[model samples]
Target chain A: EPEVTQTPSHQVTQMGQEVILRCVPISNHLYFYWYRQILGQKVEFLVSFYNNEISEKSEIFDDQFSVERPDGSNFTLKIRSTKLEDSAMYFCASTPDEKLFFGSGTQLSVL
Target chain B: GIQVEQSPPDLILQEGANSTLRCNFSDSVNNLQWFHQNPWGQLINLFYIPSGTKQNGRLSATTVATERYSLLYISSSQTTDSGVYFCAVASDSWGKLQFGAGTQVVVTP
Candidate 1:
């Protein structure tokens, strides 16, 4: 089956450093999203992208975070000046319809 | 924002037993999906039943949109079925999913 793919299954970064997570969504899917799951916590929605523009974003998706399609196949999420609390599993998803397919996820740990 | 609540936060079942997990949402939804997050933290898509019923293998799901609830049924469960099952929904005619805390299922062989 076609699936969304995320890079660097695990990443360790220093606090205050910049980090970028990349994802390749399934081809032909127009809607994309980024979600986060803090350790032992529920998954939280961060942002949704469509038509190369942000459709909606949660408060957790603040100025420190940004998303870009960058090209035809790559979708990337950047966290500027990471904080220790930013340590979590970030998931990328895409959908052609109601069912959103998720990547395995990238585990980000900020020290 | 809609609220999602899942029942029986944790369950332990004998192998081959059948089980049902429930999810309740606060409002009408245009999207409802079931996901299985394994011990390795991989979120695997299970079903997308915003309404009606759908089945795949030993797993099946039913979403009653008018009632604002959905149910996932796992039959002949196996140890491989052990994981956190999440029920996520998106209202507002958008695709941003809001997730419930999830139901942790452990099927012992």
Candidate 2:
């Protein structure tokens, strides 16, 4: 079974530093998304990308955050300046249509 | 924006016991899915039932889209089933999913 693969299973960064989380979505999926779950909280959608452009984003996905599908295979989420509150498990998902599949997730920790 | 609510914030089941989980949404949805977040923080897809019913092994799910609610049934539970089960819904074909707080399950053997 093909699955979304995310790199850097765990990332540790200092507050105000930059971090980029990478993902390789299922080969033929058309829609891609980034979601985060704060410790002990529900998962929250951050942003969605399609056709190499952002389709929708939540308020939590503010200017500090950006996503890119550079090279058509790798999807990356960059946070320009991390904060302590950014410590959470970030998930990457892709869907051919209605059934969405999620990656193992990248745990980001900002000190 | 749609609201999703899950019942019984937490549940504890002994091995071989059966349990049911419920999820309610505020409005109509085009897509509904269930996920299990394990202790390792991996979100595992369990079901994608927007309507009707489907069964896989000892697990099954039913969604009444008109009533804006869904149910997940787990039979003969095991310790591996201990995790947080999340229900997510999307109003549009490719919209972002709205996830509920999730029901934490602890299946003790």
Candidate 3:
């Protein structure tokens, strides 16, 4: 089965520094998404991308957060000036249909 | 946004036991899925059942869309099955999934 791949299994960054999370979605999948889970909390959707544009985003996905598919295969999420609260496990997901497939996740810690 | 409620926030079972986890949603949904988050925090898709029943190995899931609820049953549980089980639903076509708080399960030997 094809799966989404995320790089930097663990990332440590200083508060107010910039960090980019990378994901390589399944080749043929069209819809891509990013979700996050703070330790002990439920997973929350951040943004959804389709056809090179954002379809929908949550309030948590504010000005500081941005997503881009720079190339056809790589989907990246950039956080400018990270805050301590940004520490969490970020998951990248993709789907050809309604059923989504998720990557292992990238654990980000902001100090 | 839809309201999602999961019962018995946590559960513990001895290996070889059976258990059921419940998920209730407030509105109609187009997609419903169950996922298991392992110790490493990887979300593994277990099922995608918006309605009716489906089974895989010792695991099964039934979604009663009319009742707005879903149930996941694990039979002959093993320590490997220990993890946090989550139920998520998408109310719209190709929409974001709203997740439940999840039921944390611990299977002991």
Evaluate every candidate with DockQ and list the scores. Answer: 0.79, 0.91, 0.85
Q: Candidate 2 chain B — worst ten consecutive residues by lDDT sum?
A: B36-45
TM-score of 3: 0.98
Docking class of 1: medium
Off by over 4 Å in 1: none
A best-first ranking of the candidates according to their DockQ comes to 2, 3, 1
lDDT of each: 0.94, 0.96, 0.96
- After TM-score superposition, what is the CA distance of residue B107 in candidate 1 from its true location, in Å? 0.8
lDDT string for model 2 (A1-111, tens) is 899999899999999999999999999999999999999999999999999999999999999999999897999999999999999999999999888899999999999
| Candidate 1: pairs in clash | none
Deviation in angstroms for B89 in model 1? 0.8
State the weakest 10-residue window (summed lDDT) of model 1 chain B. B89-98
User: Which candidate would rank higher by DockQ, 1 or 2?
Assistant: 2
lDDT digits (tens) for residues B1-109 of candidate 2: 9999998899999999999999999999999999998888889999989999999999999999999999999999999999999999999878999999999999998
Chain A TM-score, cand. 2: 0.99
Q: What ranges in model 2 sit over 4 Å off?
A: none
Worst 10 residues of 3 chain A by lDDT: A95-104
